[model samples]
Target: MSRKFKKVVEYTFLILLACIFIFPLIWMVASSMKPEANIPVDMGSIQSLLPSIVPSEWFQTYQELFSRFDVFQYIFNSVTYAIVVTLGSIVVNAMAGYAFSKFDFIGKKVLFGLLIALLIVPAETLIITQFTVAHDLGILNTRLAVILPMIANMFFIYLFRNFFKAIPDEIIESVKLDGANYWTIFWKIILPMSKPAIATVGTLSFILSWNDYLWPLMVLTDSEKFPLQVAITNINTTPPVYTNQVMAILTISTIPLIIVYIVAQKYLLQGLGGSGTGIK
Candidate 1:
Protein backbone atom coordinates (compact mmCIF):
# COMPACT_ATOMS: atom_id res chain seq x y z
CA MET A 1 0.00 0.00 0.00
CA SER A 2 1.18 3.52 -0.77
CA ARG A 3 2.13 5.69 2.23
CA LYS A 4 -0.35 8.39 1.15
CA PHE A 5 -3.16 5.81 0.93
CA LYS A 6 -2.32 4.48 4.42
CA LYS A 7 -2.44 8.04 5.85
CA VAL A 8 -5.85 8.60 4.25
CA VAL A 9 -7.15 5.33 5.65
CA GLU A 10 -5.90 6.21 9.16
CA TYR A 11 -7.45 9.65 8.96
CA THR A 12 -10.73 8.17 7.78
CA PHE A 13 -10.78 5.71 10.66
CA LEU A 14 -10.10 8.45 13.20
CA ILE A 15 -12.79 10.71 11.77
CA LEU A 16 -15.32 7.89 12.02
CA LEU A 17 -14.30 7.22 15.62
CA ALA A 18 -14.58 10.91 16.45
CA CYS A 19 -18.05 10.98 14.89
CA ILE A 20 -19.10 7.94 16.93
CA PHE A 21 -18.05 9.68 20.15
CA ILE A 22 -19.53 13.06 19.23
CA PHE A 23 -22.85 11.72 17.95
CA PRO A 24 -24.40 11.54 21.40
CA LEU A 25 -23.63 15.16 22.14
CA ILE A 26 -25.01 16.16 18.78
CA TRP A 27 -28.14 14.12 19.32
CA MET A 28 -28.58 15.63 22.77
CA VAL A 29 -28.30 19.22 21.65
CA ALA A 30 -30.51 18.40 18.66
CA SER A 31 -33.10 16.67 20.81
CA SER A 32 -33.11 19.41 23.40
CA MET A 33 -34.08 21.91 20.70
CA LYS A 34 -36.97 19.77 19.54
CA PRO A 35 -40.53 19.57 20.88
CA GLU A 36 -41.33 16.64 23.20
CA ALA A 37 -43.43 14.83 20.60
CA ASN A 38 -40.87 15.29 17.83
CA ILE A 39 -37.94 13.81 19.81
CA PRO A 40 -38.99 10.12 19.59
CA VAL A 41 -40.15 10.52 16.03
CA ASP A 42 -36.74 11.85 14.96
CA MET A 43 -34.69 9.19 16.78
CA GLY A 44 -32.49 6.76 14.76
CA SER A 45 -32.47 9.15 11.88
CA ILE A 46 -30.14 11.92 10.67
CA GLN A 47 -32.76 14.41 11.92
CA SER A 48 -31.83 13.36 15.45
CA LEU A 49 -28.50 15.07 14.95
CA LEU A 50 -29.99 18.34 13.74
CA PRO A 51 -31.81 21.00 15.70
CA SER A 52 -35.38 22.01 14.83
CA ILE A 53 -35.52 24.56 12.01
CA VAL A 54 -38.27 26.52 13.75
CA PRO A 55 -36.48 29.30 15.61
CA SER A 56 -39.13 29.37 18.34
CA GLU A 57 -38.64 25.66 19.12
CA TRP A 58 -34.92 26.21 19.47
CA PHE A 59 -35.21 27.40 23.08
CA GLN A 60 -38.72 26.17 24.02
CA THR A 61 -37.45 23.17 26.02
CA TYR A 62 -34.99 25.32 27.92
CA GLN A 63 -37.71 27.94 28.51
CA GLU A 64 -40.04 25.35 29.97
CA LEU A 65 -37.23 23.91 32.15
CA PHE A 66 -36.36 27.30 33.59
CA SER A 67 -39.97 28.31 34.11
CA ARG A 68 -41.05 25.06 35.76
CA PHE A 69 -37.90 24.17 37.71
CA ASP A 70 -35.81 26.17 40.11
CA VAL A 71 -32.89 25.59 37.77
CA PHE A 72 -31.19 28.91 38.43
CA GLN A 73 -31.11 28.23 42.15
CA TYR A 74 -29.72 24.77 41.54
CA ILE A 75 -27.09 26.20 39.22
CA PHE A 76 -26.19 28.84 41.79
CA ASN A 77 -25.81 26.24 44.51
CA SER A 78 -23.69 24.04 42.28
CA VAL A 79 -21.50 26.92 41.15
CA THR A 80 -20.95 28.05 44.71
CA TYR A 81 -20.13 24.55 45.87
CA ALA A 82 -17.84 23.87 42.94
CA ILE A 83 -15.91 27.11 43.35
CA VAL A 84 -15.41 26.67 47.07
CA VAL A 85 -14.26 23.09 46.71
CA THR A 86 -11.97 23.88 43.78
CA LEU A 87 -10.19 26.67 45.60
CA GLY A 88 -9.97 24.71 48.83
CA SER A 89 -8.67 21.61 47.08
CA ILE A 90 -5.99 23.53 45.21
CA VAL A 91 -4.71 25.31 48.34
CA VAL A 92 -4.86 22.29 50.64
CA ASN A 93 -3.52 19.76 48.16
CA ALA A 94 -0.79 22.04 46.85
CA MET A 95 0.35 22.80 50.39
CA ALA A 96 0.44 19.11 51.22
CA GLY A 97 2.35 18.45 48.01
CA TYR A 98 4.86 21.18 48.75
CA ALA A 99 5.39 19.88 52.27
CA PHE A 100 5.92 16.34 51.02
CA SER A 101 8.28 17.45 48.29
CA LYS A 102 10.48 19.87 50.28
CA PHE A 103 10.06 19.32 54.03
CA ASP A 104 11.85 16.78 56.22
CA PHE A 105 9.35 16.25 59.02
CA ILE A 106 9.17 12.88 60.82
CA GLY A 107 6.68 10.26 59.57
CA LYS A 108 6.56 12.14 56.25
CA LYS A 109 7.63 9.14 54.21
CA VAL A 110 5.17 6.82 55.92
CA LEU A 111 2.35 9.32 55.55
CA PHE A 112 3.15 9.87 51.88
CA GLY A 113 3.27 6.14 51.27
CA LEU A 114 -0.15 5.80 52.85
CA LEU A 115 -1.43 8.66 50.75
CA ILE A 116 -0.12 6.97 47.62
CA ALA A 117 -1.76 3.75 48.68
CA LEU A 118 -5.06 5.61 48.96
CA LEU A 119 -4.87 6.29 45.23
CA ILE A 120 -5.82 2.67 44.58
CA VAL A 121 -8.93 2.84 46.78
CA PRO A 122 -12.21 3.58 45.04
CA ALA A 123 -14.02 6.65 46.41
CA GLU A 124 -17.33 4.76 46.29
CA THR A 125 -16.07 2.42 49.00
CA LEU A 126 -15.63 5.29 51.44
CA ILE A 127 -18.98 6.99 50.86
CA ILE A 128 -20.66 5.22 53.77
CA THR A 129 -17.83 6.02 56.14
CA GLN A 130 -17.73 9.58 54.91
CA PHE A 131 -21.47 9.85 55.45
CA THR A 132 -21.10 8.45 58.97
CA VAL A 133 -18.40 10.96 59.78
CA ALA A 134 -20.43 13.81 58.34
CA HIS A 135 -23.43 12.70 60.37
CA ASP A 136 -21.32 12.62 63.51
CA LEU A 137 -20.06 16.08 62.74
CA GLY A 138 -23.60 17.39 62.18
CA ILE A 139 -22.77 18.64 58.71
CA LEU A 140 -25.22 16.44 56.85
CA ASN A 141 -27.72 18.31 54.61
CA THR A 142 -25.42 21.31 54.51
CA ARG A 143 -22.94 22.57 51.91
CA LEU A 144 -20.09 21.52 54.19
CA ALA A 145 -21.11 17.90 53.91
CA VAL A 146 -20.62 18.00 50.16
CA ILE A 147 -17.70 20.40 49.95
CA LEU A 148 -15.51 19.05 52.77
CA PRO A 149 -15.51 15.45 51.61
CA MET A 150 -14.67 16.37 48.01
CA ILE A 151 -12.02 18.99 48.76
CA ALA A 152 -9.31 16.50 49.72
CA ASN A 153 -8.95 14.20 46.75
CA MET A 154 -6.00 11.81 47.09
CA PHE A 155 -5.31 11.73 43.36
CA PHE A 156 -5.06 15.52 43.20
CA ILE A 157 -2.69 15.56 46.15
CA TYR A 158 -0.59 12.93 44.40
CA LEU A 159 -0.56 14.98 41.21
CA PHE A 160 0.53 18.13 43.04
CA ARG A 161 3.19 16.23 44.99
CA ASN A 162 4.68 14.65 41.89
CA PHE A 163 4.58 17.96 40.02
CA PHE A 164 6.28 19.76 42.92
CA LYS A 165 8.95 17.06 43.08
CA ALA A 166 10.11 18.08 39.60
CA ILE A 167 11.13 21.55 40.87
CA PRO A 168 14.85 21.94 41.66
CA ASP A 169 15.93 22.13 45.32
CA GLU A 170 18.48 24.82 44.44
CA ILE A 171 15.72 27.31 43.62
CA ILE A 172 14.04 26.77 46.98
CA GLU A 173 17.36 27.15 48.79
CA SER A 174 18.10 30.37 46.90
CA VAL A 175 14.68 31.76 47.84
CA LYS A 176 15.29 30.90 51.48
CA LEU A 177 18.64 32.58 51.36
CA ASP A 178 16.87 35.75 50.23
CA GLY A 179 15.02 35.81 53.60
CA ALA A 180 11.77 34.24 52.34
CA ASN A 181 9.84 32.07 54.81
CA TYR A 182 8.27 28.77 53.83
CA TRP A 183 4.85 30.37 53.40
CA THR A 184 6.32 33.18 51.33
CA ILE A 185 8.22 30.81 49.08
CA PHE A 186 5.24 28.53 48.72
CA TRP A 187 2.63 31.20 47.96
CA LYS A 188 4.76 33.43 45.76
CA ILE A 189 7.42 31.27 44.16
CA ILE A 190 6.13 27.71 44.09
CA LEU A 191 2.52 28.48 43.26
CA PRO A 192 3.36 30.86 40.45
CA MET A 193 5.66 28.27 38.91
CA SER A 194 3.00 25.56 39.21
CA LYS A 195 0.38 27.17 36.98
CA PRO A 196 -0.05 24.07 34.86
CA ALA A 197 -0.67 21.91 37.91
CA ILE A 198 -3.04 24.48 39.37
CA ALA A 199 -5.04 24.71 36.17
CA THR A 200 -5.23 20.95 35.90
CA VAL A 201 -6.30 20.45 39.51
CA GLY A 202 -8.69 23.37 39.59
CA THR A 203 -10.40 22.28 36.40
CA LEU A 204 -10.72 18.70 37.58
CA SER A 205 -11.93 19.81 41.00
CA PHE A 206 -14.66 21.97 39.51
CA ILE A 207 -15.85 19.15 37.31
CA LEU A 208 -15.85 16.71 40.21
CA SER A 209 -17.82 19.02 42.47
CA TRP A 210 -20.22 19.99 39.72
CA ASN A 211 -21.02 16.47 38.55
CA ASP A 212 -21.21 14.89 42.00
CA TYR A 213 -24.74 13.48 42.39
CA LEU A 214 -24.66 10.40 44.61
CA TRP A 215 -22.89 12.00 47.55
CA PRO A 216 -24.97 15.15 47.50
CA LEU A 217 -28.15 13.16 47.07
CA MET A 218 -27.32 10.90 49.99
CA VAL A 219 -26.46 13.76 52.34
CA LEU A 220 -28.88 16.47 51.29
CA THR A 221 -32.64 16.18 51.80
CA ASP A 222 -33.54 19.82 51.29
CA SER A 223 -34.78 20.51 47.79
CA GLU A 224 -33.58 24.12 47.84
CA LYS A 225 -30.00 23.20 48.69
CA PHE A 226 -29.63 20.52 46.06
CA PRO A 227 -27.06 21.05 43.35
CA LEU A 228 -27.81 20.93 39.63
CA GLN A 229 -26.93 17.25 39.34
CA VAL A 230 -29.19 16.21 42.23
CA ALA A 231 -32.03 18.52 41.32
CA ILE A 232 -32.05 17.43 37.68
CA THR A 233 -32.78 13.86 38.77
CA ASN A 234 -35.90 15.07 40.55
CA ILE A 235 -37.43 15.72 37.16
CA ASN A 236 -37.58 11.97 36.57
CA THR A 237 -39.69 11.34 39.69
CA THR A 238 -41.82 14.47 39.33
CA PRO A 239 -45.01 14.03 37.30
CA PRO A 240 -44.94 14.87 33.56
CA VAL A 241 -41.30 14.12 32.91
CA TYR A 242 -40.44 15.69 29.59
CA THR A 243 -37.68 14.00 27.64
CA ASN A 244 -36.79 17.24 25.87
CA GLN A 245 -36.47 19.05 29.19
CA VAL A 246 -34.29 16.29 30.58
CA MET A 247 -32.06 16.55 27.55
CA ALA A 248 -32.10 20.30 27.94
CA ILE A 249 -30.97 20.04 31.56
CA LEU A 250 -28.19 17.66 30.63
CA THR A 251 -27.13 19.88 27.76
CA ILE A 252 -27.09 22.91 30.04
CA SER A 253 -25.27 21.04 32.78
CA THR A 254 -22.54 20.05 30.32
CA ILE A 255 -21.80 23.62 29.21
CA PRO A 256 -19.72 24.61 32.22
CA LEU A 257 -17.63 21.46 32.02
CA ILE A 258 -17.01 21.98 28.32
CA ILE A 259 -16.04 25.59 28.92
CA VAL A 260 -13.68 24.58 31.73
CA TYR A 261 -11.97 21.94 29.59
CA ILE A 262 -11.58 24.35 26.69
CA VAL A 263 -10.10 27.05 28.87
CA ALA A 264 -7.77 24.64 30.70
CA GLN A 265 -6.92 22.42 27.72
CA LYS A 266 -3.40 23.78 27.24
CA TYR A 267 -2.43 23.74 30.91
CA LEU A 268 -4.12 20.36 31.42
CA LEU A 269 -1.97 18.81 28.69
CA GLN A 270 1.17 20.47 29.99
CA GLY A 271 0.39 19.48 33.57
CA LEU A 272 -0.25 15.85 32.63
CA GLY A 273 2.95 15.80 30.58
CA GLY A 274 4.97 17.34 33.42
CA SER A 275 3.40 14.97 35.93
CA GLY A 276 4.53 11.96 33.88
CA THR A 277 8.13 13.16 34.01
CA GLY A 278 7.96 14.26 37.64
CA ILE A 279 6.83 10.91 39.07
CA LYS A 280 9.76 9.38 40.95
Candidate 2:
Protein backbone atom coordinates (compact mmCIF):
# COMPACT_ATOMS: atom_id res chain seq x y z
CA MET A 1 0.00 0.00 0.00
CA SER A 2 1.12 3.60 -0.63
CA ARG A 3 2.20 5.72 2.39
CA LYS A 4 -0.78 8.06 1.86
CA PHE A 5 -3.23 5.16 1.97
CA LYS A 6 -1.67 3.78 5.17
CA LYS A 7 -1.97 7.22 6.83
CA VAL A 8 -5.61 7.43 5.79
CA VAL A 9 -6.35 3.99 7.25
CA GLU A 10 -4.65 4.88 10.54
CA TYR A 11 -6.64 8.10 10.86
CA THR A 12 -9.86 6.29 10.11
CA PHE A 13 -9.15 3.66 12.78
CA LEU A 14 -8.34 6.30 15.38
CA ILE A 15 -11.53 8.22 14.65
CA LEU A 16 -13.58 5.07 15.06
CA LEU A 17 -11.92 4.34 18.41
CA ALA A 18 -12.57 7.86 19.59
CA CYS A 19 -16.21 7.65 18.63
CA ILE A 20 -16.62 4.33 20.47
CA PHE A 21 -15.40 5.88 23.70
CA ILE A 22 -17.34 9.12 23.27
CA PHE A 23 -20.67 7.52 22.37
CA PRO A 24 -21.78 7.01 25.98
CA LEU A 25 -21.20 10.67 26.87
CA ILE A 26 -23.13 11.80 23.79
CA TRP A 27 -26.00 9.47 24.59
CA MET A 28 -26.10 10.69 28.18
CA VAL A 29 -26.23 14.39 27.32
CA ALA A 30 -28.75 13.69 24.59
CA SER A 31 -30.92 11.59 26.91
CA SER A 32 -30.76 14.22 29.64
CA MET A 33 -32.30 16.78 27.28
CA LYS A 34 -35.09 14.40 26.28
CA PRO A 35 -38.33 13.53 28.05
CA GLU A 36 -38.49 10.28 30.04
CA ALA A 37 -40.71 8.58 27.45
CA ASN A 38 -38.47 9.56 24.54
CA ILE A 39 -35.34 8.04 26.15
CA PRO A 40 -36.39 4.41 25.75
CA VAL A 41 -37.81 5.03 22.31
CA ASP A 42 -34.51 6.44 21.04
CA MET A 43 -32.29 3.84 22.68
CA GLY A 44 -30.29 1.42 20.43
CA SER A 45 -30.60 3.82 17.48
CA ILE A 46 -28.62 6.74 16.09
CA GLN A 47 -31.33 9.04 17.42
CA SER A 48 -30.12 8.22 20.94
CA LEU A 49 -27.18 10.52 20.36
CA LEU A 50 -29.44 13.47 19.55
CA PRO A 51 -31.41 15.67 21.94
CA SER A 52 -35.17 16.14 21.85
CA ILE A 53 -36.42 18.61 19.25
CA VAL A 54 -39.17 19.79 21.62
CA PRO A 55 -38.17 23.08 23.25
CA SER A 56 -40.33 22.50 26.34
CA GLU A 57 -38.73 19.16 27.24
CA TRP A 58 -35.14 20.26 26.55
CA PHE A 59 -34.57 21.44 30.13
CA GLN A 60 -37.60 19.96 31.87
CA THR A 61 -35.57 17.39 33.80
CA TYR A 62 -33.14 20.03 35.02
CA GLN A 63 -35.98 22.33 36.07
CA GLU A 64 -37.67 19.58 38.03
CA LEU A 65 -34.34 18.56 39.61
CA PHE A 66 -33.59 22.06 40.90
CA SER A 67 -37.13 22.77 42.06
CA ARG A 68 -37.75 19.49 43.93
CA PHE A 69 -34.23 18.51 45.07
CA ASP A 70 -31.45 20.40 46.76
CA VAL A 71 -29.06 19.48 43.91
CA PHE A 72 -27.16 22.74 44.21
CA GLN A 73 -26.35 21.91 47.82
CA TYR A 74 -25.01 18.49 46.86
CA ILE A 75 -22.95 19.98 44.01
CA PHE A 76 -21.62 22.68 46.34
CA ASN A 77 -20.65 20.11 48.96
CA SER A 78 -18.83 17.96 46.40
CA VAL A 79 -16.97 20.84 44.76
CA THR A 80 -15.92 22.23 48.16
CA TYR A 81 -14.76 18.86 49.43
CA ALA A 82 -12.92 18.01 46.22
CA ILE A 83 -11.13 21.34 46.12
CA VAL A 84 -10.05 21.19 49.75
CA VAL A 85 -8.77 17.65 49.47
CA THR A 86 -7.08 18.23 46.10
CA LEU A 87 -5.24 21.34 47.25
CA GLY A 88 -4.30 19.82 50.60
CA SER A 89 -3.09 16.59 49.03
CA ILE A 90 -0.96 18.45 46.51
CA VAL A 91 0.77 20.54 49.22
CA VAL A 92 1.28 17.73 51.70
CA ASN A 93 2.37 15.14 49.18
CA ALA A 94 4.64 17.58 47.36
CA MET A 95 6.33 18.55 50.60
CA ALA A 96 6.80 14.94 51.60
CA GLY A 97 8.19 14.17 48.15
CA TYR A 98 10.60 17.11 48.36
CA ALA A 99 11.84 15.90 51.71
CA PHE A 100 12.35 12.39 50.42
CA SER A 101 14.11 13.56 47.27
CA LYS A 102 16.37 16.28 48.77
CA PHE A 103 16.82 15.68 52.50
CA ASP A 104 19.17 13.22 54.13
CA PHE A 105 17.16 12.50 57.22
CA ILE A 106 17.38 9.24 59.16
CA GLY A 107 15.02 6.43 58.12
CA LYS A 108 14.22 8.25 54.88
CA LYS A 109 14.98 5.17 52.84
CA VAL A 110 12.89 2.94 55.09
CA LEU A 111 9.99 5.36 55.13
CA PHE A 112 10.02 5.77 51.37
CA GLY A 113 10.18 2.02 50.93
CA LEU A 114 7.12 1.69 53.14
CA LEU A 115 5.32 4.33 51.09
CA ILE A 116 6.05 2.42 47.89
CA ALA A 117 4.90 -0.81 49.53
CA LEU A 118 1.59 0.82 50.28
CA LEU A 119 0.89 1.26 46.56
CA ILE A 120 0.30 -2.47 46.26
CA VAL A 121 -2.25 -2.54 49.05
CA PRO A 122 -5.83 -2.22 47.92
CA ALA A 123 -7.59 0.87 49.28
CA GLU A 124 -10.79 -1.09 49.94
CA THR A 125 -8.97 -3.12 52.58
CA LEU A 126 -8.45 0.02 54.65
CA ILE A 127 -12.06 1.19 54.69
CA ILE A 128 -12.89 -0.59 57.94
CA THR A 129 -9.78 0.79 59.61
CA GLN A 130 -10.47 4.24 58.26
CA PHE A 131 -14.01 4.07 59.53
CA THR A 132 -12.80 3.03 62.97
CA VAL A 133 -10.34 5.88 63.13
CA ALA A 134 -12.94 8.37 61.95
CA HIS A 135 -15.32 7.12 64.60
CA ASP A 136 -12.66 7.39 67.29
CA LEU A 137 -11.91 10.96 66.23
CA GLY A 138 -15.65 11.73 66.45
CA ILE A 139 -15.61 13.13 62.94
CA LEU A 140 -18.25 10.82 61.51
CA ASN A 141 -21.01 12.54 59.54
CA THR A 142 -18.79 15.61 59.17
CA ARG A 143 -16.89 17.01 56.19
CA LEU A 144 -13.60 16.43 57.95
CA ALA A 145 -14.24 12.69 57.99
CA VAL A 146 -14.21 12.61 54.20
CA ILE A 147 -11.48 15.17 53.53
CA LEU A 148 -8.88 14.06 56.05
CA PRO A 149 -8.72 10.44 54.99
CA MET A 150 -8.14 11.29 51.33
CA ILE A 151 -5.73 14.22 51.60
CA ALA A 152 -2.50 12.25 51.93
CA ASN A 153 -2.28 9.62 49.26
CA MET A 154 0.77 7.40 48.88
CA PHE A 155 0.60 7.20 45.08
CA PHE A 156 0.65 10.98 44.74
CA ILE A 157 3.57 11.19 47.15
CA TYR A 158 5.42 8.67 45.04
CA LEU A 159 4.62 10.55 41.85
CA PHE A 160 5.85 13.82 43.32
CA ARG A 161 8.99 12.16 44.66
CA ASN A 162 9.85 10.78 41.25
CA PHE A 163 9.16 14.11 39.61
CA PHE A 164 11.30 15.94 42.15
CA LYS A 165 14.10 13.46 41.63
CA ALA A 166 14.36 14.62 38.02
CA ILE A 167 15.50 18.08 39.23
CA PRO A 168 19.24 18.71 39.37
CA ASP A 169 21.01 18.81 42.74
CA GLU A 170 23.01 21.84 41.50
CA ILE A 171 19.77 23.85 41.43
CA ILE A 172 19.14 23.17 45.11
CA GLU A 173 22.73 23.92 46.06
CA SER A 174 22.78 27.21 44.13
CA VAL A 175 19.49 28.32 45.74
CA LYS A 176 20.84 27.42 49.18
CA LEU A 177 24.01 29.41 48.53
CA ASP A 178 21.83 32.47 47.94
CA GLY A 179 20.47 32.12 51.52
CA ALA A 180 17.22 30.45 50.47
CA ASN A 181 15.81 27.95 52.93
CA TYR A 182 14.19 24.63 51.99
CA TRP A 183 10.78 26.28 52.05
CA THR A 184 11.90 29.00 49.66
CA ILE A 185 13.48 26.53 47.29
CA PHE A 186 10.42 24.32 47.38
CA TRP A 187 7.71 26.95 47.03
CA LYS A 188 9.33 29.41 44.63
CA ILE A 189 11.74 27.28 42.66
CA ILE A 190 10.56 23.69 42.67
CA LEU A 191 6.82 24.14 42.54
CA PRO A 192 6.89 26.60 39.66
CA MET A 193 8.92 24.16 37.58
CA SER A 194 6.71 21.22 38.52
CA LYS A 195 3.48 22.38 36.96
CA PRO A 196 3.02 19.14 35.04
CA ALA A 197 3.27 17.04 38.17
CA ILE A 198 1.01 19.38 40.13
CA ALA A 199 -1.63 19.30 37.39
CA THR A 200 -1.45 15.51 37.26
CA VAL A 201 -1.96 15.14 40.99
CA GLY A 202 -4.57 17.86 41.29
CA THR A 203 -6.68 16.50 38.44
CA LEU A 204 -6.58 12.94 39.76
CA SER A 205 -7.28 14.07 43.31
CA PHE A 206 -10.27 16.16 42.31
CA ILE A 207 -11.77 13.33 40.24
CA LEU A 208 -11.24 10.81 43.04
CA SER A 209 -12.86 13.02 45.64
CA TRP A 210 -15.75 13.90 43.37
CA ASN A 211 -16.55 10.29 42.40
CA ASP A 212 -16.18 8.90 45.92
CA TYR A 213 -19.50 7.45 47.03
CA LEU A 214 -19.23 4.59 49.54
CA TRP A 215 -17.16 6.33 52.21
CA PRO A 216 -19.43 9.36 52.22
CA LEU A 217 -22.48 7.12 52.36
CA MET A 218 -21.06 5.17 55.30
CA VAL A 219 -19.94 8.20 57.29
CA LEU A 220 -22.61 10.77 56.55
CA THR A 221 -26.16 9.92 57.63
CA ASP A 222 -27.45 13.45 57.00
CA SER A 223 -28.71 14.02 53.46
CA GLU A 224 -27.67 17.63 53.72
CA LYS A 225 -24.00 16.66 53.91
CA PHE A 226 -24.04 14.14 51.09
CA PRO A 227 -21.89 14.64 48.00
CA LEU A 228 -23.23 14.62 44.45
CA GLN A 229 -22.50 10.93 43.83
CA VAL A 230 -24.33 9.81 46.97
CA ALA A 231 -27.09 12.31 46.40
CA ILE A 232 -27.63 10.88 42.90
CA THR A 233 -28.23 7.48 44.47
CA ASN A 234 -30.83 9.02 46.72
CA ILE A 235 -32.53 10.52 43.68
CA ASN A 236 -32.52 7.13 41.99
CA THR A 237 -34.01 5.28 44.93
CA THR A 238 -36.70 7.83 45.79
CA PRO A 239 -40.23 6.97 44.74
CA PRO A 240 -41.46 8.01 41.27
CA VAL A 241 -38.00 7.66 39.81
CA TYR A 242 -37.64 9.75 36.67
CA THR A 243 -35.10 8.43 34.14
CA ASN A 244 -34.66 11.84 32.57
CA GLN A 245 -33.85 13.42 35.92
CA VAL A 246 -31.31 10.72 36.69
CA MET A 247 -29.66 11.26 33.30
CA ALA A 248 -29.71 15.00 33.85
CA ILE A 249 -28.07 14.70 37.25
CA LEU A 250 -25.43 12.31 35.91
CA THR A 251 -24.79 14.65 33.02
CA ILE A 252 -24.47 17.57 35.40
CA SER A 253 -22.10 15.68 37.68
CA THR A 254 -19.89 14.66 34.74
CA ILE A 255 -19.36 18.18 33.36
CA PRO A 256 -16.87 19.35 35.97
CA LEU A 257 -14.68 16.31 35.47
CA ILE A 258 -14.73 16.84 31.71
CA ILE A 259 -13.75 20.45 32.14
CA VAL A 260 -10.90 19.59 34.48
CA TYR A 261 -9.45 17.00 32.11
CA ILE A 262 -9.67 19.35 29.17
CA VAL A 263 -7.96 22.20 31.00
CA ALA A 264 -5.20 19.94 32.33
CA GLN A 265 -4.78 17.75 29.25
CA LYS A 266 -1.43 19.18 28.23
CA TYR A 267 0.15 19.09 31.66
CA LEU A 268 -1.38 15.73 32.52
CA LEU A 269 0.19 14.15 29.46
CA GLN A 270 3.61 15.63 30.23
CA GLY A 271 3.47 14.65 33.89
CA LEU A 272 2.43 11.04 33.30
CA GLY A 273 5.02 10.63 30.55
CA GLY A 274 8.02 12.39 32.14
CA SER A 275 7.48 12.56 35.92
CA GLY A 276 9.41 9.41 36.76
CA THR A 277 13.02 8.14 36.61
CA GLY A 278 12.85 4.50 37.75
CA ILE A 279 11.74 5.23 41.34
CA LYS A 280 15.17 6.17 42.71
Best by TM-score: 1
Angstrom error at residue 245, model 2: 0.4
- Model 2 C-alpha lDDT per residue in residues 146-212, reported as the tens digit of each score: 8998888887888898899999999989989999999999999999989888888988788779988
> lDDT of all predictions, in order shown?
0.87, 0.88
- Please, what's the RMSD in Å of model 2? 4.4
Q: Which residue runs does candidate 1 get wrong by more than 4 Å?
A: 1-17, 269-280
On lDDT, the candidate that comes out on top is 2
What is the TM-score of candidate 2? Answer: 0.86
Q: Please report how far candidate 1 places residue 173 from its true position, in Å.
A: 2.6
Error of 1 at 99 (Å): 0.9
Instruction: List the candidate 2 regions with Cα displacement exceeding 4 Å.
Output: 1-20, 41-46, 269-280
